[model samples]
Target: METSVLLIEPDPTAAQEITEILQEGGFLPVTRQSFEAVHDSVTDEMPPKAILIGTDNVKESVLSFISELKADPSTQWIPLFILSRTNEDSFRIDCFNAGADEFFLKPIHPKELLARLRGWVNRIGNFEESAFRDPLTKAYNRRYFDLHILLELQKAQKNDYPISVAFIDADKFKSINDNYGHHVGDLVLQGLSKILREKTRTSDLVARYGGEEFVILFPKASGDQAANRIQTILEYVRENPVAEYEGQLRHITFSCGVAEWKPGLSVTEWVKLADDGVYEAKGQGRNRVILSNLQTSEHDHLEEKKKVLIVAGKGMSKSIVCEIDSLAYEIQEWQQGIEEVPPEICIYVIPPTKGFDAGEYEQFRMKHLPKECKTLLLTENHKALDSFQIMATGIDGYLRGPYLPGDIELGLRRLTNLN
Candidate 1:
């Protein structure tokens, strides 16, 4: 399929030159002589997938034009590239700061320009295939839910955080489709999706799970806590009616089943537990939320209470002990100056101290560390070490500062799947 590009060049000669190259490259290129006329010329039916702005001058008006394009809600999300003859540092910086996905110098190499432009358009198309939204309801689809569920599981395992999942099904939905047309059924779904989006916390994720069902992931919430929130949604659905069909207002209620995520639990198992909860909710009645009765066996508790050793200088080691003590693990303290590492400890924490060197620690670890173990290091700051230096050491992770949350946590979670 030919990708459409909106090319804006103040100079007619340059616009005509680029237009021919785009046509030869099999792109449907629309040329405009003025940036001010861009929005008006491109109507909703024929909106370009991306826009390219080219000019030799780097004036405030040029920068303002980019800013104005960004400010206009219709043009904001569309990819925009800036092409100019001026390659000054300030000019490039201002263009990107305003909003330019790609910047190129003038005297365009037609092949290079087309390759780069097509690359961005193709990438956006691939991403849209795996896009988060469910077209019918405007909620996230199961793709987004599955991706986040696994991520949240890894985080819960690493950081000892609580997470919950709920499976929600609209009661007697097929009857609604049978009585009223599928059109009304779609409206019912859209209405329910809006209610779920508005009612849930921003931290929570709600997704459409095929027909008549939806799923939600509640990070940092237990099953009971998830149940509490679902109760309110249940009440709201009861109070509200969906659509007016045949002079009668149609109403719908949902049944929800909630389960908490646990350490050592696989994503499939976690989802199964939630599905089981839905089964119970359906068995009990159609319009209720039920929390699954799950017991943490002695084996599970023992796993959660796994021992973690901290190896560092006295000051830093003790500080790490304090931080990790907040978690479920049993803390074992070891002075970094010690000759040997304890064999039994599988997980280790090494918080930063002044004058510590990662290069030297790489050598020390080879000699004394156990063959199979997890090591988490804390550097001076975010920029204390480059990613290659951090990665070269082959540690499991870096510690997140108590104040600056999420950076290390998210980075480490991503690193786990690289294997």
Candidate 2:
């Protein structure tokens, strides 16, 4: 199907000419005269792929309409272009500030306008696809899983519909990288990804979160149903070879953690719980599935014993030490530039500019931080939060700079309760 374009222009002659030009250029153009008509049309029908507003001589009404469209979620994703009569420098800044995707001069050439419109249409389609797909697996990724699973979780909370998540990790994956080349390991990963895509339903999401780990979001699936699915996949992989490298078959096994979505739990909380279940499976011995809930009090009790380490910088380290000490919990503190003492909770209070190396910190978090331990990163820099979030190396909570002793206590308490 051809892309749709909404052309908003008050001049009848200009609108007719543009409509003819767009149709000839292989687009389906819809013309409207006023902001109210465009608003009504978008509300009653699907939004156009892009909106072209003629700001020929900046009118307050037209500017207001553009602002309104940009603010509305329903129309925010639509690419917007402005046709201006003013000089490029003067209007270019204002047009972009007003959320225009592209700006064109008045007496627009039919060919140039069509080319720009087609370019934007292609860009938007690519953006939408990238937003929901895993970069590595080419499967529906976490963004889609979060949106769709949250909706299902809400329904489960209201109507008692069962929903669960399974966290899967390749057993002894690091050894594979150590024994075979990383290239061979990557081939195994790709083969496993293909098998997962073939086995799962279109409704399910299989996201490759990071190295050797994946999450499956299952809506309307009970704990038993989730475990059964994961078990089937495990058995299939064990029996079927993924890759033949170095004259030997590469077989893969996975450890799975299953947790049913609970009422009044946020999406983040549900994911954490499922991840904890995965840790439990790994602890019990790899290549198994573990489930947790109120009904499984033994599992819950075992989970509480998990430890966390809090690593703090020089300035905030003292504050964290003082706070945790007052709480009557014995915590070992590691000073800046010293070896981090292995603790259940590691608190880093280092300054933003002097953050730890990414690869080193991640190795510490994964190897030193206990399986149950969570890391609380307390820094004064917001940029550090973005960096750690992207790395996703088990830094659970972040506190900005100039924090009070109470803030440190609160962060520790939250992390403790989460564990």
Candidate 3:
């Protein structure tokens, strides 16, 4: 694609010279003689890749134009250059502070100007490519998805256009790793990702949302449309298995959660609802699509009410505390050096003392205890047990060392009755 430049200079002679220089140097320069004209041109015409403002005699107006462009999010990312005849240090600082991407002097050499403009254009192109394109699947990444989805959602909310989000995850992904090794697992993901890319619409955004999970942002799509599209992709994968790995056929399946964009909800909230639907699909079966109903009670109410407190110990007890607190509970960490216990569910890390002091322990408990609170004590050495026993008057649970994810999950499940 040919690079385009917007040259904002009121001086007719300077504008003519710059336009000639840019045209000779392979840039399509669009010149504007006035500040208001430059603003109108940017809004009406196709946006240029870069903008150059002559700040020699009209520094204030040039600065104002740059500021206006920077303030508008749509034009802010375009590279901006400032040309000035003033002191290099002061002018450069002023330009940079006002968000200019580059600065040049008034007596511009054609070659140098072309080189800098080309460099800026190349750099901006590379940046945009990197920002939008996924490294693995060569599809759009989450950053692009987020930005595009936000814009689509706004249009949908304002003008009644349709938008939907689909949360996708590879089924039995861990089993893939365990069976064929990680290399083959990666190959499976890449293969599935390629198939997904081929299946999706050109206008739709398909992005990897970490690990085996992917998300698709569909503009002008209804919930039924999104579901049908996703189901077709899933069916295609099941029918055509990847057979290139070790002469073994690998059947890849996916689960999807779909949700439509609604007004008055942030993008994060909309996505979380979609994620909940994905979990529902996984719970029902491996390969299925679940559409989320905003009014449904399937969403966990406990998650809204649960609060967790995490405490750290010098030894294995820190892990133990974290594990015990993970059971069916929402938790936050207690800041170190805070004398007061902030929450009702408190997890205290018991340090091993040489001699257990019952009076001191009782005083400590009395100081930190809140009425009707559940306390979990974590200990590393058995010697700390004596102190815990002394301090165990109000304690609800005690955990020892060497905990695993399963153990923590199981313990929390039992503790919170969330089996």
Q: Which candidate number maximizes lDDT?
A: 1
Measured on C-alpha atoms, candidate 1 has an lDDT of 0.71
In model 3, which runs have C-alpha deviations exceeding 4 angstroms?
1-49, 53-61, 71-75, 83-93, 104-110, 124-134, 139-160, 198-203, 239-243, 246-249, 296-419
Instruction: Compute each candidate's TM-score over C-alphas.
Output: 0.45, 0.48, 0.55
lDDT of 2 at 336: 48
In the order shown, the candidates' Cα RMSDs to the true structure are 14.4, 13.9, 14.6
lDDT of each: 0.71, 0.69, 0.69
Q: Which candidate has the top score in TM-score? A: 3
Candidate 2 residues 1-419, lDDT tens each?
77678888878888898889899998888898766657655533245888988775446665656655654434656889887666658557766655578888778898898888888888888987887777666766655564445444544554556888988888899999998889888878877888877887765668886788888877678888988888888889999988788798999888888888654344555677889887888899888888866354444433332233445543344435434442424466654466554566667554645654567777766655667666777665566557645356656776785443245556766877732
Q: Which of candidates 1 and 3 is the stronger one according to TM-score?
A: 3
Model 3 lDDT tens row, 1-419: 56788998877888899899999988898887666656545533257888888875566666656766764444667888886767668667777766698888777888888898888788877987887787766767766665556445544664577788999999999998997798888787778778878898776778888788889888789888998899888889889984368788788888999998654344556788899998999999868999886764544342443455655433333334323331334556665476543455655665533333456646755666566666666554566665446455756666663222333334444445654
Whichever of 1 and 3 has more lDDT, that candidate is 1
Candidate 1, superposed: residue stretches over 4 Å from native: 1-130, 297-419
Residue 2 CA displacement from its true place in model 3, Å: 4.8
Candidate 1 local lDDT, 302-398, one digit each (tens): 3244355656555445434433332334667655466543433323333322433677777767766676656666654454566676688787666
